[model samples]
Target: MEAPLITADTLVALIPEILALAFIAVVLLTEVFGSRSPNLSSGLAALGALALAGSATVLLAAGFEGSFFGDGYVVDGFALLFKILVGLVAFFSVLAAARWSARTGDTGEYMSLILAVALGASLLVSGRDLFVIFVSLELATIPSYAMVAFDRRRRESSEGGMKYLLTGVVASSVLLYGLVLIYGVTGSANLSEVAAAFTADLSPAALLGLVLFLSGVAFKLSVVPFHFWTPDAYQGAPTNAAAFLSVAPKMATFALLLRVLIEGMPETAQAYTWLFALLAILSMFAGNLFALRQTNLKRMLAYSSVAHSGYILAAFAALTGPALETAVQAVIVYAVAYAVMNLGAFFVVELVGEEGKSFNGLFRTQPALAVSMAVFMAALVGIPPLSGFWGKAWVIFATAQAGAWVVVGAVIINSVLSVPYYFGVIRSMFFEEPAGVGPVKDGSGALRFSIYAMAVFTVLFAFILGPLVLLAQAIGL
Candidate 1:
C-alpha cells in the first residue's frame, strides 16, 4: 500500500519547522498592526528561534527518533543536536541585527528572513533524500541573498548581494541537475535505495553527478576556487547577516554533505576520500594565503572561515579508516567549537568598526571588549584551551590516528600559517592605537551581552568535550 504523505510521525518530526512557520506569521502580523520597532521585532524573532530550539530539545529528550516521509527526513541525535545549534545562531543573528536594522527601517522583514533561514537549516540537517536536501538548501539559501543586500545604504552591500545571488543560482542549478542524474541512476529518491543501487563501479553519468553535487556543496562551504564570493559577501553584507551566514548555514550544509556522502553514497566513500583530501589541502592554502593579506576585519575573518572549512574537511578525509567514528565526532565538535568562537569574533567586529585600524589599542579604552575579542582570535588560531584549538586538535588527531599524515601535516601547517593573521587582530586590539578623536562606546547592550556569552562559551567549551563525544557516539547512522 502507498503511504500517506502526512502522518502523526511526520508531525512529531517537524515540530521545529511548524513552530518556525507559526512564528513567522505572528511576527509578520505584529509588524503589520503594531508600531515599527527593531527591538520588538528582534525580540519576537529571537524568541521564536529559541522556542523552536526548546521544542527540538524536548523532542530529543523524549527519544524522538524516526525516519519519516518515506525516509526523506530523519529525526535523530545528529539532526536534533544541529537543530539546537542552528537555533542559537538564529538567535544571535537577530540579536546582532537589532541595531544594524534600526537604520534600514524594516526589522520585521529581515527578522522573518533570518527565521526562514533557520527553518531551512533545521530541515536541511534532517534531509535524507535528494529532493528534501535540494528544497531545504534552497529555502536556507534564498533568504540569505536578500539579507546580504538588505543594507541598501551601502553600494558594497548591493554588489555583494548580487555576486552572491548570481553565483548561488548557478550552483543550485548544477546541484539540481546532479540530483536528477542520481535519481535517474538509482530509480529512487530515497537515500537507502540509492545506497543499495551503487555497485563496484560508477557509470560516466553517475561520476558526473557526483562531481556536480560536490561542486555545489563546495560553493556553500566556501571551498577554494568556488570561495571567491565569501570575502566579498561578508565585507559587503551587514555584520549581523555575515555572522548568521558564516556559522548557521555552514553547520547545516556540513550536515547535509555528511548525509549525502555517508548515507546516500557509501559505496563510493573510500573512492571519494582522496578528493576530500585534495580539496582540504587546497582550501587551507588558498584561504590562509588570501587572509594574511586582508586588512579589513570582515574580509580577513571571511578568509579565516574559508580556512576553517578546510580544517573541518580534514575529518571527512578520514571517513574510510577505522577511525571513522572519531572523524565524525571531530566534525561535530569542530562545528560547535567554530560556532561559538566565530560568532563571538564577528559580533566583536559589529561593535568595532570594520577597518583593522579601528581596533588599534582597543585594550586602552575597552579592556573587557578587547580581551573578549582576543579569546575569539586566539581560538581561531587554534591556541591551547580555546574552542578553535579543540576543533582543530580533533581534526588533526583523527587524521593522524587514521594514518592520513598528509592531511595532518596540511592541518598543522595551516594552523601555523593562520597564527599571524588571527594574532594580527589581537595585536591591533592591545599593542597598537585606536583610530580618530572620539571615545569608543562599547556598542549596544544586547550585542555586548552576546560577545560576553560567546566568549565564555569558547573558554569553557573544554568542559563539554566529554558530553560532545557521547552525543557524537549516540548519533549513529
Candidate 2:
C-alpha cells in the first residue's frame, strides 16, 4: 500500500502540538546544559503557552478547520476553543510553578513536566480517534503522576502519587477494554465511524463498553464512586500541581467525554444521561457532605472539586435534542468559571497555608488575599454576578429546559449545601481571632500574579457572559 500523503494543511493543523513539543524540548535542554535557572525555564514555558494561545486565537478567528491522519486529528472550532483554554491554564500553571520551584529547587524538570502535561492536554482535546484519545490521556496523566510525587521530601507526596498511579492504571485498563469492545462491535476505531455503526438498539456488549468508557472518564472527572483518590492526591501533591491537576485535566477530559458521547455514541444518549444523572447526584451530596467536615484546606477544595464535577455532569445529564447546544455551552462555561475560581482558591491555599485554621484573621493581615478568597467563596456558592453563579445558573436553566428537574433540584440543593464550607474559609479569615503574631509569608511575585489575575478574571467573567455564550455556541456546533 502506498503511504498516505501529508499535505501542508496537515502540518498547519498541527502547529499547536508542534509548538508545545518544541517548548518542552527547549525547557528540558535548558535544564541540562544551559543557565539552570528556574525563572528562565518557567518564563520560556509561560511565553510558549501565550504564543500557543495566540496561535489558537488566530486560527479560531480565521475559522480554520481541517482533519488529518485519516481523521484521527482535527482542528476545528471545538478543538480551537479547548486548545485556547488548555493554553491559558498551562500559562497560569507555569507561572505558579515558577514560584514553587524557586522555593523547592529543580526548576527545569518541573517546568518541563508541566509543559509535557500541557502538550498532552492540548492533544487530548483535539483527538478524534480512540487510539489518539488513549495516547493523549496517558500523556496528560503520566506527567501528573510524576508531579504528584515531585515533592519527594514529603511522605504524603509519595503516598498520594502511589494511590493516584494505581487508580489511574486500573482506570486506563478498564477504558482500554471498553475501547477494544467498541472496536470489536463497530469494526472501527474512528469515532465518526463508530457513531455511524451504533444503532438505537445497541447490543449488550456495546452497552457494556459504553459504561466502561464513562467509568474511565468519571475517574478523571473525580465523580462519586470513582473519586476515591482525589482528596488524598490533592492533599499530598504539591499545591501548584494540585491546582493544575484540578483544572486542566478535568477540562480536557470533559472535552473528550463530550466528543465521545455526542459523536461516537449519540444513539445511547438516554442510557448515558440517566447514568450521568445518578453519578451527578451522588457526587454532589457526597463531595459537599465530606467537605463540610474537612479541616484541611486542600482536602476541602478537593472535595469541592468533586462537587463541581457533579455540576458539570448535571449539564451532561440534561442533554437532549432541544437542549443539546445549551448543555454544551453550560459545560464549557462552567469549566472556564471553575478553572478561574478554583485555581484562585488554591492559590490562596498555597499562599496562606493548607490547613483551614491557618486562614484565621487573614483579613487583619493579608487583606487583599482575604477579600479575594471571599469572592471566590461567594462565586463558588453560586452567588449572583460572579462567574461561578452564572455557570451554575446556566446548568440549571439547561436542565430545566430539558425537563431534567431532578438534576436541577439536585444542583440547587448542592449549591445550598456547599455554602457552609465555602464560607467557612471566609469566616476564618475575617471573623476569627489571629492564631499567629504576624502576617503569612507573602507569596513569590509569580504566585501573586497568578492569584490576582485569576481573581480579576473571576470577577470580570460575569460581565463578559454575552461574548462567552456566543463563543460556547460556536464551539457546540
Candidate 3:
C-alpha cells in the first residue's frame, strides 16, 4: 500500500501523549534501581508530567487544527484548551500527591496511575468518534477505581472503590447501549455523521439512545440524581485522590458534553431541554443544600463540586453563539478556580494530618493553612474578588441571556443557599477552637508550595478574566 498521509500537525499532536507514556515507562523502570525509594519514582513521575504539560503547551502554541485517524481524533481550539487544562490538572495533582503518596507508600503506582488518567482525559477531550470517546473514558475511570483502593488497609477505601466499580459498570453499559442505538440509526459512529443524521423525522428509538448516552455522561459529571456516588466516593477516598478526582474528570466530561450535545443531539434539543434542565437544577440544589450539614471537610467539598457541576450544566443548556461561549467560559474559569480551591483545601487537610495523626486544631496549629483554607472556601462559595465569583456571574449571566428564567432563578437560589454551608467549613477553621490536640505538624516544602501556589492562582485569576474569555471564544465555544 502507498504510504499513509503524514503531516507536521499529526506529529505534534502526538507529542504529549507520547511523552506521558514514555514517562510512565521510565518511572516504572527507575523504581527497579531504587525499589525502596518510592520518592524517587514519584519525583521522576512529577517531572515527567510537567514535561508532558510543557510539550502540550508548545504544541498548542504551534496551532494545529483538524482531525486524524479518518476523523477519529480531533485537534481544535476546544480540544487544545481542555487538553492544556488536563495537563495542568495532572501536573498539580502530581504535586498534591507527592507527600500523600510518600506517606501512603504507593508513590510509584500512584504517580503512574495519575499519568494514565491524564492520558485518558486527553483522549476523551480530543476524540472525534463515539467509539474512541468510550474507549478513552474507560481508560480514565478504571485507573481511578484502582487509585481509590490503593490503601487496602482502609475499609472505607475498599468500599469506595467497590461502589465506584458497580456504578461505573452500569453507567458504561448504558452509554454503550446508547451508542449502539445511535449507530443503528445513523449507520456510523463518527460525530459529524451523527450530527448530519439529526432531522425532524428522527424515530423515538434514536431519541431514547441519545438520552441514554447523555445519562451516562451525566453520571460521569456527577450531576444530581446521578450524583449519589460522589459524596461517598470522595469521603472514602484518600484526600489527595479526592482532590484529583474533583477537577480532572469533570473538566474532560465538560469538554465531552460540549462535543456530544452540540454534535450528536441537535435534532432532539426540544425533547432534551427538560432533561438538561432537570440535571442542572438538581445538581445545583442537591449539591449545595446537601453540603450544608456535612462535618467531614472532604464530603462537603464533594457536594460543593456537585453543585458546581449543576451550574456548568445550566451553562451547557444555554448553548447558542455568544451565550454558549459565555457558558463554556464560565465552566473553564470555574474549573480553573475550583481546581485551585479544592487542591488548596486538601493541602490544608493533609498539612494538618501530616503529624502521623488525623488533622485537628487546624486554626491553632497551622494558621497559614487555616487562612489559606478560608480563602479557598470563600472562592468555592463564589464570594467576590475571587475567581469563582466571576465564574458564577458569567454562567448566571449566560443563563439569563438564554431566557432560561426558571434555571436562572434556580441558579441564584442555589448560590444563596450554598453560602452558609461553605462558610460553615470556614467557620470551623477560623472561629471554632480546636476541641483537642490533634495532628500538630507543619506542611512539607512541596505541600506548602502547593497551597501557596493554588491560593495565589485563585486570587490572581479572579482579577484577570480577559484571557480566559478570549480563550473560550477562540475555542469556538
Candidate 4:
C-alpha cells in the first residue's frame, strides 16, 4: 500500500502535454487580460506548438524510454513518432487558425481550443491504460465539437456541430460500456493486464465488449455505416476546423485503435482481422461511390476521407503474425501521407470556394495553386511518384502478403473508382472556362505556407521513404 515514487523521467515524458497545457493558459489569459488581439493569441499558440515539437525532437534524440505512473503512460519510439506528428499538425493548424481567427475575431477561445485538442491527441497516443485512453479521447474530441460551431453566423456550422456532438456522445457511450465490460472480465484497466487475461478462452461478455469497442472506434474513423455525420459535419464546419478534424482526430483514433488492438488484444487478432476486413471493404466502396456524385468539394473530400480510412483499415485487416509488422508500417506511412495530402487538399478548398464549380479556370488564374491542387489530387488517386502512391502500394502489398485477397481487390477497385472524382476536380481546374473575370485571391501567408509546404512534402516524400520505412519499422518494435 505504499505510494509509487514519481521520477524526473515521468515529468520529461509528459513535456508535450505540459507544454500544451501551459500554452492553453497563456492563450486564455491573453484573451482576458490583454488587448484581445487575434494575431498575438495565434502567435503564442504557434510558438507553443513549435516549442513542443522542439522538445519532442530533443527527447527523441536523448533516446529516453520508460513507463510512468504504474505504466499508465509510456514513452517509446511509437509514442515519440506520433507526438511529433501531432505537434506538426498542431503547428500548422494554429498557423491556419491565426488567419481564420483574425477574420472571425474570436482569437482567445479559438487558439485555446486548438491547444486543448492537441494536448488531448498527444496524450491519447501515449496512453497505455484504458482509463487514460478514454480520457484522452474525450479531451481530443470535446473542443472539436465547439470548433465545428465556431462560425455561429452560419446555420450549417451549428447543424454540423450538433450532429457531430450527438454522434460522438453515442459513440462514447458505446465505447465506455465496452470498456466497463472488459474491465469487469479482466479485472484490470491496464492494457497489458487485459491482454494477459485473454490467454484463456474469451467469455461472451468479452466478445461483446470487443465488438462494441470497435463499433465506437468506427464512428471516429468515419468508416461506412458509422459515417452518416461526416459530410454534414465537414460541410457545415468552418473550413479550417474541417481540415483539423479530418487529420488530427483521425490520427489519434488510429493510434488508439492500434494500441488497444495490437498491444491490448493480440490474442484476438485473427478473429478481429476479418471484422476489420469487412469494414474496410464496405468503407472503400461506400466512400468512393458516394463521393463520385458530390458537387461540393467539402462533401467530396469527406467521402474521400472515409475511403482513406478504409485503406488504413485494410492494413489492419491483414494483421496475421508475419504480416503484422508490415501492416503497422503501412498504417504509419499511410497516415503521414494521408495527413499531408488531405490537409493540402483541404487548404486548397479553403482558398478556392468549396463548390466544384469554384475550381473552374483555376489553371488560367492561379496556375501555381492549380498545379499544387493537381499534385494532391494525383497523389490521392495513388499515382506514382507521390506520397499517396507509396502509402496505398504498401498497404495493398501488405494485404497480399497476408493473403487477404478480397481486401486487396477492394483496394484496387476503390482506387480505380476514386480516379473520376479526383480527376474531375483536376479537369475542372485545368480544362474548364472561368466563372469569374480575374485571378482568385490567394489566402493569408500562413495558409499559403501550409498549402505549399504540404505540396512540396507530397512530391518529395518519395525521396525520404527510406527514413520513413525505418521509422515505421521502429514503431513495429
Best by lDDT: 1
TM agreement with the true structure for every prediction: 0.98, 0.98, 0.94, 0.97
> What is the model-wide C-alpha lDDT for candidate 2?
0.88
lDDT of each: 0.89, 0.88, 0.78, 0.88
Over all chains combined, what TM-score does candidate 3 have?
A: 0.94
Expressed as tens digits, the lDDT of each residue in 1-477 for candidate 2 is 865668888888888888888888888898889987878888889987876777888889989998889889888898888889989998998888787786677887888788888888888988889989999999999999999989978899999999999999999999988888898899999999999767678889988887788788899899999999999999999999999999998998999888888888786775568888899999999999999999999999999999999999999987777888889899989999999999999888877779888899989977888899999999888888888999999999889988999999999999999999999889989999988853445457888788899889889987778888988877675
Per-model C-alpha RMSD: 1.3, 1.4, 2.4, 1.4
Q: What is the lDDT of residue 15 in candidate 1?
A: 87
How well is each residue in 59-84 modelled by candidate 4, as lDDT tens digits? 87788788888888888888888888
**Model 4 accuracy (lDDT, Cα):** 0.88
lDDT of 1 at 174: 94
Any runs in candidate 3 off by more than 4 Å, and if so which? 1-8, 353-361, 436-443
CA error at residue 477 for candidate 4, angstroms: 4.1
| Residues 179-280 of candidate 1: C-alpha lDDT, one tens digit per residue | 999899889998888887665488898888888888899999999878989998999999989989999999999988887878888768767788899999
Q: Which of the two, 1 or 3, has more lDDT? A: 1
Cα lDDT of model 3 overall?
0.78
Clashing residue pairs in candidate 3 are: none
